[model samples]
Target: MNKQQTETMQNTLAQNKNLLQNEQTLVNKQVGLNINKNSENLDDLLEFVKKETQTFKDISARGSSYVSIVKSENGTRFVINKATNEKLGYPTEIYIGYKDEHLMIFNAEGMAVNKLTVRQTKNKITIYNTKLVDEIINHFGIDFSEITSKSFAEGYFENKGREILYVKLL
Candidate 1:
């Protein structure tokens, strides 16, 4: 090709490359929007599942207590580990929490209490084996109620003259 024509062609190719890059950026942004939507939906489902549920823990770890809470308006900028001044869940605004490994379930007001267990008014479901119940409920990728209890091994033992229940989660 002539030198002038070659220069013109190179310029055209460079412009096309720039155009392609811009198009790719736009596509990436579109994908980001879709991802945000799906993440919100997943968070909604997680909230529904965890609502009004109680967790039980054996606190031999000498850890403190923690409570994670989501605010009403924003889905990002959550206050995680507030007692430790640690802020997390910033982008989605979901509530995250950390305790000092003391092993306990908490209520909305943040106490070592299970607000929903029928048999555990004493803050421990050691007798009725709610550990197994919670483990079964937390299983992923299947209908929790449909899973046979034999899928997991449930165990029992005595602790300080009290029955302690144990289960292998997942």
Candidate 2:
């Protein structure tokens, strides 16, 4: 191979290594978050996140790093960092379980009043809850609808080393 091509390959490898390292740092932070497993605290946590997002508007921007709290259908709660332009992947259900349905949207102010519509393809699961999504948009008072479930799933898969939380059964 030409010297130029070899240099280009080396550069690409270095970039990938950097991305992997950044992702690993994010994963470690996520794993270290202290989230309460009890359902009762869900509201409090949701409220705190809502308030934090509002208070830290600049930090909450899309391009900025922020914390994302997610609770799956099986009631597992975890906090992850929203890094870069990439959306995080689907919750651990896709890998840890074989069924799809029932993803609960938690709102501290008791505002997630909607039904979930689950759509599953070979490697992805998209859950759409219009009311819930709307509530989130309204709660955060921002237009983040562009970040769809599909995008999150894509992001999740692309960032291979990131941790995916699977909530323990109560």
Candidate 3:
């Protein structure tokens, strides 16, 4: 080969080598970042598991009057603790009414036209309804997207000889 052609080939080979080295460096950095991110995710998962285990133990130990609001992809659930459920007469069917940032649960036997079925477990009574929860959240201007669950203290009152249990949302 001519000297000029030999020089040109050398330059091309150097440029190719540089490009390959740069690409390898970038790949190495990406791999390191991915490893660090995965470690962080594992740590977060472990922490969450520990927290939930402790919460379950605490709930099991207490028979308290409270309302827990839980949000999931399927819908929102209002869970009444066992003590509160007993106070509400262990309702098989319930009427949920919302007004002024308060949700009231009343026994539905011969009392209300609109009613929701109650899902009773040993520790709690759960009522699931999507629209009512959505309306209450929207009306109260509550941003519940980042929140998974919340608990509120319950209050009891009687009106027109009807018993009602209520939780005020803030």
- Give the candidate number with the greatest lDDT: 3
Q: Report per-prediction Cα RMSD to one decimal.
A: 19.3, 15.0, 20.7
How many residue pairs collide in each prediction? Answer: 6, 1, 0
Instruction: Please give each candidate's TM-score.
Output: 0.20, 0.22, 0.54
How high is the lDDT of residue 85 in model 1?
A: 20
Pairs of residues clashing in candidate 1: 63-100, 64-100, 75-92, 75-93, 76-92, 76-93
Lowest lDDT 10-mer window, candidate 3? Answer: 53-62
Q: Estimate the overall C-alpha local distance difference test score of candidate 1.
A: 0.33
Ranking by TM-score: 3, 2, 1
Q: Where does model 3 exceed 4 Å of error?
A: 1-65, 73-75
* Alpha-carbon deviation at 96 in model 3, angstroms: 0.7
Residues 77-125 of candidate 3: C-alpha lDDT, one tens digit per residue? 7678887777778888888777566777777877646987777898478
Using lDDT, rank the candidates from best to worst: 3, 2, 1
Using TM-score as the measure, which candidate wins? 3
C-alpha RMSD in Å of predicted model 1 compared with the true structure: 19.3
In angstroms, the error of model 1 at 68 is: 49
